[model samples]
Target: MALFAVLSGLSACGLPRSGPTKGEIRAGSVEEQGDTFIVPVTAQVARATAMVPPLGFTNGFLGAGVIGSDVIRPGDVLGLTIWENVDNGLLAGPGMNSTALQEMQVDGDGFIFVPYAGRIQAAGNTPEALRRIITEKLDAQTPDPQVTVARIAGDGATVSVMGGVGGQGVYPIERPTRTLSAMLAKAGGVIIEPEIAQIVVTRGHHTGRVWLKDLYSNPQFDVALRPGDVILVEKDQRNFTAIGATGAQNRVHFETQELSAIEAIAQVGGLSTNAADPTGVFVLRDEDPATANTVLGRTDLIGPQRVAYVLDLTEPSGLFNARDFMIRDGDTVYVTEAPYTRWQKLLGALTGAAGSANSLSKAAGN
Candidate 1:
């Protein structure tokens, strides 16, 4: 009876097994004990949906009108003009001279000394406000004194632009209507492989990200610039590893731009014909350990989930919109080969048997 049972099990190999079908395999399913199975179809779908790139602005503080404000700092050269009752004439030029009747340079104490005015605070005040203050000081000595203050050297209006831009440096904010794009243009636009969507603006201790596409497309995404604002255009080239059946196995640079899964695959030279498993194409995203630990420790605030996504490209439908899957900064993509790829040696034997069977059948009929 035991021998018969063993033979029955061996014969069952040729028969169809009571398990998942081809559809189930394509849908991402694994057979478990007995008739039970574990299928991550819903999870896979959710992951694919989550992998969709964020469409709009991702960073920076953009709102109506200007927030905070730029202030004057030390080491700035101010062009001072003074009108001395039409007798002293209109004094306008660079630097301070005896005939010029104007003062320049703010002391270490943030004070500028002018003729008739002993010491005045010029730093941290706008040019217009400084003009009014200088006028009031001169008015104490002369009647109806007219004073004008212009920044000769923009050392005071300092702003730092970094990341992705061709030129990253500390530039002067000459105009009040300067926008983010203007700053980038001054820095020579973005460098190669730039993340066009991820731009970060850091002011004091606060930092925010802005999406370039949204900033240009949506009028509401415009934000006024303030002095001392550090604009950092960071590339999102996190720690992404491309492996499996690609033409080249390489790491991608993630700047302030959006990278789709298809693009990432192409960057490595597409898939290798001999080793690629089209159905097993997937991405593994590691959960941010720091964020996950913080969320687990703090229960009061709404914490993010520690989860990753796996993408599959075996389905014919997935090819239609493959670009929609945005590859995160640090993700790993693996392509597997089909299991039946190693069975090519058996094809000749099978072909010969089929031919012989057909010949025998034809001979019998004749």
Candidate 2:
């Protein structure tokens, strides 16, 4: 009797209820629990759902390029300079010097006022192209004219870098810094944490995010930067908690925007060989309440829109199903302990206690 009591105590302390009861794992309802939906692990079940997480670098964000042909636009200021070997007329007229400097601003109609050239169109041409236009216009009047145009100041070629960057300021989107990666480097990369996986890029009315981990592997997302584009490099503050018979019972930080269930399981060190039940591995997720019924295919379910997915790793195809199942940011993985493990704890406890009690009894008798 003393041995039995000691064994029970040790069993309870060691095994400590690895997870929910078998019946609870097998039978649970959205209506009863107020939000838990039960999903079985199967290829069809995993295939039924479609999620476009911000993971791959080649998503819709790369489909489009910079705005308006990347051409010059209004609000741009250009500094125009002209050189003449011999002064003739217009730019370098009779009494003028060999060089003429003019500061021009692109007006609302995408035109710039050039001396003697009248309202010339500068908004849609490159600096070199604009120089040629001006030089050509003065070809007959001026003798051997050379012209240069520089973007002195403009909002159309500048981008704003904010959030998780060393230089959180506006930088020009010059030819060398026209791509996302170029701007990131010029801004001193991510300051808060370069390890972050997502960078939010907003251009005009459309806003999208990219996974930096994928970007490092894929160059497609290193898209050309556009005027008015805002780049935000934020920390990868997403995580999921792992508990129960799995190796670790702590919050696992996200390394990428999307994480496969199997990846998450592997990160937590897989299941505990001694205690984990191959069939009792589960993931708890809180789905959107409004679409849970239709999405989960359980009209009978009623509760708080939380769902649990049971993965039976015993089957050969179980790993495939888990691979396809994407884990959300805050899901929890639980691997219930096997029934035999519980029994072993009890038996071992009883054996040690029994030996101690037997020795005590012998000592008293002596």
- Residue 33 shift from truth in candidate 1, angstroms: 10
Tell me the TM-score of each prediction against the true structure.
0.58, 0.61
lDDT of each: 0.59, 0.74
Model 2 reaches what TM-score against the true structure?
Answer: 0.61
lDDT by residue (71-182, candidate 1, tens digit) is 5567666777776664443242334321343437676778888877768898889888988888887777766777777765344555788877888887666564367777
Model 2: residues with Cα > 4 Å off, grouped in runs: 1-21, 24-35, 50-147, 152-156, 161-169, 174-199, 203-206, 211-226, 233-238, 254-258, 289-291, 294-296, 299-304, 351-366
Candidate 2 clash pair list = 7-349, 7-350, 30-302, 31-302, 34-303, 34-304, 35-303, 35-304, 35-305
CA error at residue 327 for candidate 1, angstroms:
3.0
lDDT (C-alpha) at residue 24 in model 2: 70
Best by TM-score: 2
Cα lDDT tens digits for candidate 2, 118-215: 67898888887888888888777767778888875366577888888778887766666778888888898766544564788887777777666656
